[model samples]
Target chain A: MIQDIVTVFIKEFKEILQMRGTKRSGWINILVVIGVMGVYMPLMSGREWVTNLLNPISFAWLPFFLVIGVVADSFAGERERHTLETLLASRLPDASILLGKIAAGVVYSLGIGITSLLIGGVVANLGSLEEGFVYYPLDFLGILWALSLLLALLMASLGTLVSLRASSVRQASQTLSLSMLVFWVGIFLVTRFLPEEARVLLSGFFTPERLPMFVAMVVLGLVVADAVLISVAMLRFKRSRLILD
Target chain B: MNDVIVTQSLTRDFKTVRAVDHLTFQVPYGTVFGFLGPNGAGKTTTIRLLLGLLEPTGGTAHVLGFNSQSEGHRIREQTGALLEHPGLYERLSALDNLDFYGRVYHLPAIQRRSRIQELLEHLGLWERRHEPLAGWSRGMKQKVAIARALLHRPKLIFLDEPTAGLDPVAAVELRNDLAQLAEAEKVTVFLTTHNLSEAERLCGLVAIIRAGKLVAFGSPETLRSRRKNERVEIYGQGLEQSLLPWLDTHFGVRQAGLVNGHLELEWPGDRELSSLVRALVERGVGVEEVRRNKASLEEVFLDLVVDGDKEPYTA
Candidate 1:
């Protein structure tokens, strides 16, 4: 079983990275950050611009996975492409399929997470005029990275389930995008509540804050949730229904 | 005991639609079983059930002597499948994709490498091994799909229109490969397709499905023998429509339809085609040409779908 899952993961890994859309999105996102900070760097001497420049690592990771419309559509896209039926019929197990998809999404999502964090670091140091020239707080990077992985977990599984359930690629992606609304909203609520004193601490949750304890907690939570959702998705996968039509 | 796949009233329904209606069929080892149905006729659905990709809403299926729906994990280890319009990560190379799935089968890394090399070479994918799949042509991608299906050396393979999008040559190549695999590896194949000619050529036994229901199941020749009427094509410039009743009653044809002034008749058989020509000549109808259809798979499919519960073909 472990071998089956790893096989799928490795394959899905290469497949997703080379995805044209993801490659293009990575570059586009990089340029967008450069352009935004290009303006922020010169203006950082102003205090008003400082907070806006450094505040939300929340939305940073969000936009990267937005390309996961491709990821979200992975399963349905296979069916649309006529590959899902073949894949399910293959010697590869269904759990392996689900894991491969999640692995792909995680790896791809990680790219956006890291890139955004890198830019977040650059911008924080340059300081939008508001910082009067400041260095980006490393805490922001931590928060954004961790948040991205957490978000990737729930998001990828949800995408898999939706892809499995929908009849067409368009319908599957549309449904997946809707579920993302909840995640984005969660970001909104969490970011709004960040107190200045707690920014570094809360952001610790985002970054690899030595919260070895916190890390353990997150891992424990994810393992439990991942196992539950995986079994649920496995149970839900209806190969007959997918290929019948 | 040799049966590799079996279904007992296996059914799948979606809300109000019956996708596979009580489908019960099986294939013994060493046979190329063909499953025939029109598009949307539940052929693919049945394949999914056999593989345990989809759970049956009712009934049950056994694959490799295991309960397909519940013991799917075990069943997967021994089966290979090539479903319609199969997919792969466009970003990976042909070789990498195969190697990756090879791992899913848990082939040791050394063995996996050899296996990938073996299969890729066999599939003619060796030259394009390193190119990312995103850039491969449709045919190339399909070959990759085939390689993926056979990577594990599975005991039973389910090919649901495996040749669906291939060029004629590739389709033929795949069929030959499947045959070779069956003979040499002793693989049991459960194939489904809408292409009657392909089915006729490769399938040992054929099952016909219509509107999600099994309409006919038998050896290809058996079904062919069951075709009710001997259809003789008639070509002439002016065979008056007025001669129909006379032809039907005199020739013992139960019913007939005309296309472009050609008469299509369903009736009792004749020992000779010249006899139908003589009958036409007596009515002053020019019998331009007469030929026996020999009961094609298409005819069998049409009989099941369009005929509905209509009168059986007598001849």
Candidate 2:
């Protein structure tokens, strides 16, 4: 089973790399994102990028959004291009296919996220020549890695579920983007309209002394959501239903 | 011969429609079995059910002695299919497409490489294997898809309309290649096709379905011979106006007419050619040539479908 999943993962990752019609174009797209997030942002921010405590948290959400770009194509794109049925007909188990797709999305997003972070650290150091070499603290680096991976898994799970039901890749992408928009807007509205006492209590919970607890809660929530979404996706991944869809 | 596939009262329903209704048949080993039907006649659905991709609503199917629903993975592991569409990845190269499936089937590196090469070279696509399939014509893409299906050397292969939309030359080419491959590999083939001529040429046994029901099932020779309307054509001068009325009046003749320069007669089962020829010569129609004709598979298929429309469902 592990070998089968790895085979699917290899094919999916290769497809992701060749998604832009050519390897050169695909690499260029990846480079553009890396250039902006890794080089430009860190260069302009300089030492602040490393010293700022919130930098890791902000960067963790980067993979959350980045995974959405490619995960929408995970199943919907195969169905749209008439390849899903053949894949389903193969000997590979359903679990392998599902996990391979999720793995592809997670790996692509997390790889980019980590690479950008590393490049940002280097750029921060290079740009801060007068201040000498600088890097993110070890504890913060660990938080960045964990949060980025959890967030990527969260998005990958959500995106794959949507892609499975969507009639086309365009529909899947639009639905995912709209869902994210609605979620963020709803959170913003709820927070803004919260009672003053509740707002203060929430703010108190995020104090530096309690920051680790807050991150832990967030990670727990993502983990729970990922598990539930993945479970539902697996339940719905019947060959009969997918073929009809 | 061993029965590679056996389905008893197998059925499939989609919402309000019964796509395949109580389909029961057996496909023997090492033989080409044609599932012949018109559009929307449940051919594809039957293939899907037999392949274990879709579960039957009614009875059961056993492929290679394994229950389709319970042992679907085992069935798929040993069987290959080219479904309703070519199902090739257009963005990938032809070689990549076959190689991907080879890996999925877990062919070792050396065997996979050689199998891909053998299939592609045989199908005349080896030279263009590295080029992306997106730029190829539909025929070329279909060839690559066929190669992909055969790369694993499955014991049983389901091909859904392998030549559905090809032009004459390309269709014949694909048909020839498919025949050679199936024969050389000694594989049991469950082929679904609307083309009666193709079925006649390739299949040893055929089952025709209409409105999700099996209307007829037998070898091509048996189906063709089942229709009792034997035709006879007599070609010569003075065969049109003078013979038309006389031929029409005869009791053995079901219908008679001038086709091109020949006198054509549809003979009932009890009729004899000698009696017809003696009557034709006596009528002063010079009989230069006379030949007996059996119903073509197309005629039998149309007859069966028409007959099926008039009768209640019984398979």
Candidate 3:
């Protein structure tokens, strides 16, 4: 099963790398994202970027969004291209295929996030040459990696479920995009319309002294959501149903 | 297993429509078994059922001695399929496409490489294998797909309408390549096609289906010989359309028509041809040449498909 997963992973990554018709274009897209988020943003943020506690927390969302762009194509793209039936006909176990797809999306998303962080570190040092080479605290780096991984897993799980039911890649993309839009709107509504007292209480709860607990709660919430979504997707992934789709 | 595949009253229904209805058949090992049907005749559905991609709504199917419903993966491990579509990743090169399936089947690297080479070279596509399949002609893509199916060298392979969209020359070329490869590999091929000539030329045994029902099953020769109507052609002018109704009403003459200035008649084989010619002469018909002909597989197929519900043809 491990070998099967790796095989599917390699195949999927190869396809993702050529999603733009050429490997060069695919690399360009990834590099562009890394440049904007990794280099430019860190350089503009100045020294506060490394010291600011909120920076890593906010950066975690990048992978969640990045995964959405490609994960929608996992199953839906194969169905649209008339390749799903043949794939289902192969000897590959269902779990391997599902995990491989999710792993591919997670790795791509987290890989970019990690690469950007490392690049951002360099950009931060280059900008702060007068202040001596500085870096993000080790604890913050660990938090960013963990948070990015969890978020990437959450979105990949959700995207795979959407892709499974979608008749085409366009439909899956629209559905995923709509969900993201809804999430953004929900956040905006909560942040902008919350009562003054509630906002105060929320800010107090997220203060540096209590930040670790807050992060732990978020991690716990994501772990539960990821488990539930992955389970549902697995349950829905029977070959008989998929072939009909 | 003596038979690579056996299905007993295998059935599938899509809501109100039955896609495969009570199909029962067995395919012996190492033979090209043709599943012939018109469009929407459930040929694809049956293949799906046999491959275990789609479960049967009723009855059962076993492939390679594994139950399709419970051991589909085991069956898939031992067989290959070229489904209704080529199913190649068009963005990838032909070599990449074959290589992907090789990995899916868990072929060792060295064996995978040699098998891909052997199939591509045999089909004359090795020279152009590095080019992406999206730019290739439909025929070329299909050849690559065939290579992918054969890469793992399974004991059985299912091919659905492989030459449906190809030009006549390409279709014939593909058909010839498929025949040679199937022979050389000694693989059991379950081929589905609407092309009667193709089926006749390649299949050792054939089954005909219509509206999800089995209409006929036998070799091309057996089906042709079993056709109830024996055809006779008489040439040399003066055979009028007016004589068709009389011939149709004759005791042994089933139907008659004037085609290309020749008199065409369908007679029961038990009837004597000499009496018919004498009667034609007496009727002022000039018979320059007379020929008795056996029905072609195409004619047999047409008869069974058109009047398929009459009775099932058994081997």
TM-scores, chain B, all models: 0.86, 0.94, 0.96
Candidate 3 at residue B292, lDDT?
90
lDDT of 2 by residue, B14-131 (tens): 8899999998888889989999888999998888888789988899999999999889999999999899889998878898888889999999999999999998899998999888
- Which regions of candidate 3 deviate over 4 angstroms? B249-254
Error of 1 at A46 (Å): 19
Off by over 4 Å in 1: A21-82, A91-96, A99-245, B135-137, B165-181, B233-246, B254-267, B270-293, B311-315
List A-chain TM-scores for all predictions.
0.63, 0.96, 0.96
Rank all candidate structures by their DockQ, best first, as comma-separated numbers: 3, 2, 1
State the iRMSD of every prediction, in order shown: 3.0, 0.8, 0.8
Per-residue C-alpha lDDT of model 2 across residues A100-134, encoded as one tens digit per residue:
99999999888888998888988877865887887
Interface RMSD, candidate 1?
3.0
User: Candidate 3 chain A: worst 10 consecutive residues by lDDT?
Assistant: A48-57
lDDT tens per residue, model 3, B1-315: 699999999999999999999999999999999999888999999988888888789999999999998888899999988998999998888888898889898889999899898899999999988887888999988899888888899999999999999999999999999999999999999999989999999999999998898888889999898877789899976789888777866654547778888988888887788988898898888889999998998898888787665566786
**Once model 1 is optimally superposed onto the true structure by TM-score, how far is the C-alpha of residue A94 displaced, in angstroms?**
4.8
lDDT of 1 by residue, A1-245 (tens): 67777776766655554454555664665466544543443245333333454445454555346545546666777767666765666666667678777777776666655554455445554534454555445664465566567666666776787788777779987776676688779989888987887888767666645665675686578667766766778898655655655
Ranking by lDDT: 3, 2, 1
Q: Residue pairs in steric clash, candidate 2?
A: none
Lowest lDDT 10-residue stretch of candidate 3 chain B: B248-257
